[model samples]
Target: MNDHDRTASEVAHSLSRRQALKVAGGSALAFAAGRVVPSGADAQTPPSQPADPMQIILPETGITLPTDEVTFRWVDSGDSKALFFRAYFDAFTQAHPNIKFDYLGLPWTEIAQVVPLGVRNGNAPDVFQVPQEIPIAEAVREGWVRPIDDLIPNFPAWQAGFPPVSFVEGVNVFNGRVYTFPRSTSRRAGIVNYFNRAYLEEAGYNPAETPLTWDTLRDAARKVTENGQGQYYGIILVGKQVGRWEQYVRNMGRLAGSSAGPDDIDYRTGEYVYTSDGYLAAIELLLALRDDGVVFPGSMSLNDPQARAQMPQGVAGMIFEGEFTLPIWVRDNPDFEFGVSPIPTPSASFTPMGYQNTGTNHQWLYAESKLPEVAAEIFTYLGSEAGQLAFVSITGGSDPSVFDSVNQRAPVDERMRTVYGIYEKYMRLCPDVRIKNPETSQVYLRLQRPTPSFGEIVQGIYTGQLEDPKQAMQDLQDRQDQALDEAIEAARRDGANVSRDDYVFPNWDPTTDYLESDYAELG
Candidate 1:
């Protein structure tokens, strides 16, 4: 059978097959040099500038349009510190007086609560920043946002400017249409093991030849513990918040080979494997650290911020954190010198491991915009090299530069170098399980909602509340599988096109990460 027939047959046997989708919309006209071009058609040259400020070539279409009096309603998840947004808005407006922006910069927390309400009320901004925690699929399905392929000219070429990894499944793409533009690289690229350089030296260990294996890291921690003499801890952990615990589990588990997060999939089988050897080994590692008395006291009671503070304050030798932590340390504890390294992997794995998110917090233009051309202009500009640079300069390189040129053009601060190195060498992209059935994302979210979460399984073991780490993981695996099945079945009942095959990851080699061709074959 051909691919289409195969898909139909699979859907029939497994889940539901959707009917032909008729999107309610009119297509935009792409006019260039007095000729009409199909949307997403390739352009030979960059868009030519028009004599009138109001009349400029649309980058996506190579079409010239009058943009004067067009006001783009932009809502962003930024606070007062995000002066870069205001700067960009002023610069863009000054450059083009005919075009205007109605910009609202709100805290991320507020944006999360307000944007959804605005969207539901048909009063949402023309262009808005996508929420970090919420899945973008929900908004696309609800018709709150529209695909950019038709709106933006030469969409695929425009998207190619970004790194291949940025196109996360079920995030930037839905129903084979590109939805959002990646605004920034992940602030937390992977699990960063930040260590006090002085502490390592004082412990008679060479910082250059730091730990690369799990066993050696433990030995190094013991050395730091011996050097501390009851005054400090070798390693600090944050167990109070669910996210912190989850990071610990993921960081440690990656070292052993577990790719299963709250809703992550095993690329090899397309199933959740929370009880894999990697996860259980990670839990056991934490238990060993506790028994060895290397973990900081009050870890269970301490909040994330409190736990994070210990490393900078010299109370802990190392911290398992993210790229953003370096900036905090730079601003607050400038006198303290430190270095970043990846979480040590097992001897068997050999390669260092860190978690990576495929997509990022992005900016999307609402489908129901009054001034689409104006909104498209702002969207395209912000995603451009110049616009991204302005934001990157202000953010102090905590986020990896999306533009390739920005990295080369940098003054190259120590922090930026560290982030670059970590992302390039250590970070491993986390598998997205919701690629096939976007509706199933809720199953993973629900697992995090409960008090004693899958991440908290380690904490349970650490506190003596749970005895067998393997059993706890096994139980979670079963629960996750059930949740996955229920979600797929319910979504099929609701006319969503999904099946068990969506979860399958055929011909994926976990050891080598496989090649891009392997992924293409599965698709």
Candidate 2:
């Protein structure tokens, strides 16, 4: 059967209603064993009308829900996060008694493959979590997902409560339409320096006072490392992992005020600045750290998990991580103490630039779902202070909340509070290259494609395999530009409303902020 041709009834009926966990006739029940049907006489009687919604004091979500029986299917990623969602769903179910949830949980690896295929097969989850790497615009453009602006009647009013930057063009809204709501921003929303208190104290430095400049940081690292005399090391770098390397490079590059990192684009000119001076400076610093013997000896060979293992064992003095790292460390070693601070720069005079507002894990409603209204209600609830707070608390308040009310309820750990405070002030959305061209949008997704992998390039530099950072970066730039040009030309031939002119900016100045005026078009 053609997936697009399936009717709502066909889709709904096709699901294994026999096995679904159900709340039938306002009564909670486990997964139904098998479909139970009324006999001839019992089936003939008139069905009872649903209880008056006005009478049910559904916990105040601040939004009104229509009185209807709704069965919502929701798929999510990650086991820990899934537990959080289940708790939220339970709370939601208690409030909206008429609705039932058929929850499906899968890891991100499976989710990327399963969700879209499931949706096309007409076995779609009404509300599904979209991974950060997926091209949301492409999903919407291809008619795989729907806009929530019209589906949720109170969406506009509710969205207005969030930070205005949340709706920046190409960040959240695409082509003036809102499709997904960010469940939470990156836990490490800004550049945070996570350091071990014991190590700092052992080195005769104050843990509470983080180094503000890169020179001081390097000195501190050297002092703590003691020329690799003990098991203790200055830092952990997962040189083999692209994400870990990319993060450090981007945060450092920001201080130098240039476009860098995999996601960074010169908003002013729509140009790839992977080879910018700031990026080179970042690499040079890493190389310097390596030469100083401050980095863990096995860093070049280790992956993220292996590298992070050094933290809990007190073998590393400092690390760069997001807010979530604190909780994970706490869970592993409750007695261990640490401090959080901003990533150090070359000088205090340099502007702090690692401000990133890129939405990481977001939730999108399937356009083909039969119960969008119900999904919208659940979506709004999840984004609410009450819902976000539940997740923050479950995650140990390490992940900062998007709403002020939820942050107010954040755990009073000094480190968490300090990190959240910095996040509130400095977090920003990085310029997106994904929205720039046909090819760039799929850069993260199409790993098999011919573009250079930032991970391999960084690993080469770290292992002394790649001699010149500048030449390597320039080569990367040439290849990336070529890919973009080819994609643009192909798109134009296919009658796409895009041109090379959309990417050019004659008046762009790298020294100044790439404000909205710098761009000819956002694309």
Using lDDT as the measure, the top candidate is 2
C-alpha positional error of residue 252 in candidate 1 after TM-score superposition, expressed in Å: 1.9
TM-score of 2: 0.68
Model 1: lDDT to the true structure: 0.58
Error of 1 at 139 (Å): 5.7
Error of 2 at 350 (Å): 2.1
lDDT by residue (11-108, candidate 1, tens digit) is 12221111111111143212110111222232453333222111122234343445556676787744211334444454455446776766675544
- TM for candidate 1 is 0.67
State the lDDT of candidate 2 residue by residue for 47-108, as single tens digits: 12112110111123344555788778887753334434544455456556787777665544
lDDT of 2 at 296: 75
TM-score of each: 0.67, 0.68
Off by over 4 Å in 1: 1-160, 163-169, 175-179, 185-189, 259-263, 298-310, 348-357, 363-378, 427-453, 456-468, 494-497, 520-523
lDDT of each: 0.58, 0.59
